[model samples]
Target chain A: MQKEVMFAGFGGQGILLSAKLLAHAAMNQGAEVMWIPSYGPEMRGGTAYCTVIVSDRLIGSPIVKNPTHLVAMNRPSLEKFAPVVKSDGVVMINSSLIPVRSGRDDVDELIVPANDAAIEVGSVRCANIIAVAAFAARSKMVDLEILRECVKSQFASKAKLIPLNMAAFDKGLELAEGK
Target chain B: MAKVLMKGNEAIGEAAIRAGCLNYFAYPITPQSEVAEYLAKRLPEAGGTFVQGESEVAVGYMIFGAAACGERVMTTSSSPGVSLMSEAISYIAGARCPAVFVNIMRGGPGLGGILPSQGDYFQATKGGGHGDYHMLVMAPDGVQEAVEMTMQAFPLAEKYRGPVMIMGDGMIGQMMEPVEFPEDLYVPPTNKDEWATNGMDTRKSDTKNIVKSLYLDPTVLNDHNLLLKSQYDRMKEEEVRFENYNTDGDYQALIVSYGTMSRVCKTAIDEMKAQGLEIGMVRPKTLFPFPEKAIHDAASKPGCKVVVSIEMSMGQMVEDVERVVKGKTPVQWYGQCGGEVPTPQKVMEHIQSLLNS
Candidate 1:
């Protein structure tokens, strides 16, 4: 009933936004959740990261040193956080860019070619959505339908982008299910 | 009444508006700037006013001015910014104005890292500013508690006719969680006709009201100090709130903490408990009231061997714990400062070391 996820990537890669999408979906499902972002200078360019904790019970200490899930969008993130994930946890790596594997044997590793899948869906920016969708499909932690609804509302101000992002998400979900 | 996920800072701002906060003036600072940002837009809709003051110092005075006029006013800042407002805070204290200030503290003595820290424990619980005074300080561990504390702060400030503070760390300020504002918090505004300076016409008297902290006579100042001291004592008696967890049976150690750090300790206590080392925890909800008696009682438990003060500072709240324990129990301090929050594992290690030693 409790899940802690650490999502890490480059500054502009939509790591924080993807986490928000997950948080919004979780809220709709009546789960308690907390999304805490690293509010420092890495936000301008270096490595960006955020911690998302979704629990059925009250969440304690949003800062998770060891997470149950880690979505690493790049190599450095995977190398840094992969080892720290709790045993039997899930680690989703953006294999298109990471080009490295989680060395740990205890965790369930999912290597999704997120960037390549995003290219198939039309925009590189959609890679985060794709990776998170793959994560959702692999874990089944949140409903994909609810996730799509969250995505639609999140981009309600820009209606034109919904179809493209949805396509990206579906593609990611399909690929992740195949794996 | 529906629950919505909100950032901690944004929720605090909304709670203020729901509590009928009429004026907000604060400068932008990391970790807490979201509070001002959220208010900048929402305050207008709530029929309230918002001002991005030129600096923290200026914003402090603006809050003082609004509070002096008997309006529900609030401002928020991080460590260094709070330091800048200490001078005005002191003056507001001396003048006996009811205002709310929130410190989403960051690590500090200087422009330290913009991460959650309890380093301001001394600055907040003790006197941040000079001149014998205290601001009623409330510490919240999570976003929901943050909202509730903020809503309660307005009435507490009004009742005391003195400043009240909501203290949290950057983690609490930046995190997002589901919360629902109580319908009653959106109650009608408080009456400010009594002590406020709403022009001479509003008072309907010949004498004009002057708001100043200066008292030329030492005897008069002494009287003012005594009044403030008495109010503080009253607060201690009536407002001391704390939560004791898993302390029913004999426990090997007692952990004392507040704000976000307390939750971290709770997690560590669970781990220690599973290891057959019974660790009880006392979390203070109101820091200024100190919960001295509760702490003393917890430390006086039959099996309690030591009281550990867990903080995000070098060691500050430990002093209060030590003072209250009065050597009744061995008081220990463990912390990580300058943006490094201690993980439960780290805390358990500290606890285990204490148990062994």
Candidate 2:
């Protein structure tokens, strides 16, 4: 089985980082994975998106048009992607930014105040970590431990941000559970 | 042999270093410029030679000079830059010097675009340098393969006495993926006194070796072409690599693609399969010795009706696919050139239309 997820938002919102972290977590679980980021002109202040494919078998393509999961970090991203989510697929929206809900009833919609949750934890930059933690908890796509490992690896060089990021991740898990 | 996350270009440089290649000569080009930049720092640390030649033209000849000295040497460029290197590439092929060249292709008819493009298919497989010479072209779609193929390319070049190219696009070059370096370093055979014109002191007779592609006699040139053909024939027998996906079932259509385009085709196939359409893919890993036999076999399968060639170029490899299918399967072409990649939806629509027709 294969699952494709797209994380899209404005630049510096950590959309690309979140997608990569999920892909890395899937890879650590011994799954075949691919992460493709938007390149060229589309990357500068435009909608920066990344596509991640995680599969039990070898992944065929890294380009995903209809993703099983769509994580929209902004209103523009949610407006652009809500229509493309597959039936019964999950669409996670950052409630703090996006006001409207997904139009499709066939899919599962989760509105998490990712930015607010991150702010509550410490900083707004941790919003991506929060979204990733929520996605991991709800989708069960990858183990929470693996997500933690991915987070650690991503920030391994930074070293000092580990504790705060872990706290932010925990807060995200609680928020996901509350939903 | 632990996996480390590395950009594709960086991995290729590391692999080249581990292959015991001492001399690296290259100019900077986007998507693949990282390879030169990485080697600039890494090669010196490893006590190897690294020079950023003034231009791709100079870099190619610099490689020629090092290869002539019987040292394992390499150079890298993208499409437009590679066009400049073609002059030297042809010279190197004609002189029968072994060197590894990496082309991390960007879109181009002429400085086309910088995204990623497989449009150099014809240039890489059939148009290396010029005149009846074929370089072994290896198309690596991912970072791990990029690393492994680069390490393998040097020895393969020496084994065949010609240039070997690791052809990839910007996506493969710039993207970061996990790759493990090979456990053992490959030490190529020393041929300095034998073939290279290093010096004449050690030989029994003090004679100068001339390294030139200019064979004045027509018959000698014909003989040289024939020898190259024989070597190509041997390579055809030895080096066809491909990946087959979901080909067992009765399929309405088959997708033929390679490199980054193949990855896109895979996603399209999966989505089509979910919609109850049976489709398969034949992804060629080696472009030159064009997996003709595999194409033939795939076409011959029962219930395989239409074969579509998806590429980043305008119908270059499609001709080869048509040649191999032999009029049995209806062959078609779908492509986007100048670095514009065809999305999975576009590919699916093309397949759906073909299947419906």
Candidate 3:
């Protein structure tokens, strides 16, 4: 089985990092994974996105026209990528920034106030962590433990931020579970 | 070593290091700047030399200079940057200095967009610079292959004593994949003392070692050209590398593709297989040798009617494909050059139409 997830937002929204973390997690689980960033001439406020493809077998194509999941960190990303997601796939909406729904009744729509939750937990910088955690929890594409370990190691370079990110992770999971 | 997730550009830099190449000179250009960015930090850590040249032209000569001294040297650039380096590449090729060049190709005729493209196919396999010299070129489909090719390129370059290029698109440079570098792939630079300009005292030779491309004398220049042609002929005979997918039984169509574009075609072939349609593919790993025998043999299959060249450029490699097939089967070309990769669905549709025709 193959699953492709697209993480998209403005350039400074940590979109590429979130995708990389998920891809790393999937790779650690022995799945073939490819993380492709849209390395166009993106400025600070311009659109930036990346796709992470995980497969049981060798991944033939790194490019995915229709992803199995979309982690839209902003309204434009949601509006742009929502229509292209395959039916019955998971679409995560960052409710703090994006106010509209995916408007698709066939797929599972995940609504999480990632930015607000990150702010509540500690800093808004951890919003991507929150979004990915909630998405991983809702989608179950990867083990939550593996995803959590990936998150920790991602911030291993900055040890002080681990606790805040862990709190954000918990909050995201809690929010996704509707608690 | 354990597997690690790495961007193709970064992995390429590391691979060069693993191959014991100690010198790197390059100018940064997107979609491939990461190689220079990576080696700038890592090369120093490995007790190597890293120089960010003032320009790609200078970078090319930097490579030429180090290589002339028999040092394992390399440089990475994109399309326009590589264009600027072509002069030096020609000089290095004429002088028979072993060097590695990584072109993480971007779009264009001029200063086009910084996106993945196979637009440099003609320039790479055909001669980018003047004269009748071909850089031994390899096109890698993915990051793992990129690493292996980058590591192996050093030895291949030394073996040929000519420039060896790793031709990848911007996608290969930017994409991240898990890679475990093969152990024992590093072959130390060999046979350089005989001709390398490493000083007479160093080699303990009576004659001075001079590296030059100047052969103004007609008879002498013709002999040199013939010698180069003979080496290229040897390469064509010995170094042809390609992969055949699903070509075992009777297949209706044959695909000729390379680099990242081949991967998309593979996906299309796989999806079509489930629908009871069979298509086979020949992915050329070495673009220089052109995989002539492989293409000819694949196209010669009794069931194969039409051969298609799917590339990211506007029918560049298709020329080589058509030449190799030599009218045995009808050759078709489908591609895009504006940096938008042709999708697998589109490829499938094209092949389906071709079969119907």
Alpha-carbon local distance difference test for all models: 0.88, 0.86, 0.93
The residue-by-residue lDDT of candidate 1 on A41-91, one tens digit each, is: 666668999988888977766668889989999999999999899998889
**Best by the lDDT measure:** 3
Cα lDDT of model 3 by residue, A1-179, tens digit: 99999999998789999999899889889999999998877533499999999999999988799999999999999999999999999999999999899999988999999999999998999999999999999999888899899999988999999999999889988988988
Which of the two candidates, 1 or 3, achieves a greater TM-score against the reference?
Answer: 3
Residue-pair clash count for candidate 3 = 0
Candidate 2 residues lying further than 4 Å off, grouped into runs, are A95-124, B2-6, B176-178, B182-187, B190-193, B197-209, B217-220, B244-254, B267-281, B300-304, B338-340
DockQ each candidate and list the results: 0.76, 0.43, 0.85
Please tell me what DockQ candidate 2 reaches. Answer: 0.43
Kindly provide the TM-score obtained by chain B of candidate 1 when compared with the true chain B: 0.96
Collision pairs in model 3: none
lDDT (10s digit) by residue, model 1, range B123-204: 8878889989999999999999999999999888877778899999998999888899986765444545556776776565
Ranking by TM-score: 3, 1, 2
Query: Candidate 3 docking category?
Result: high
Identify the leading candidate in terms of DockQ. Answer: 3
Residue B83 accuracy (lDDT) in model 2: 95
Q: Whole-model lDDT for model 3 versus the true structure?
A: 0.93
* Per-residue error (Å), model 2, residue B226: 3.6
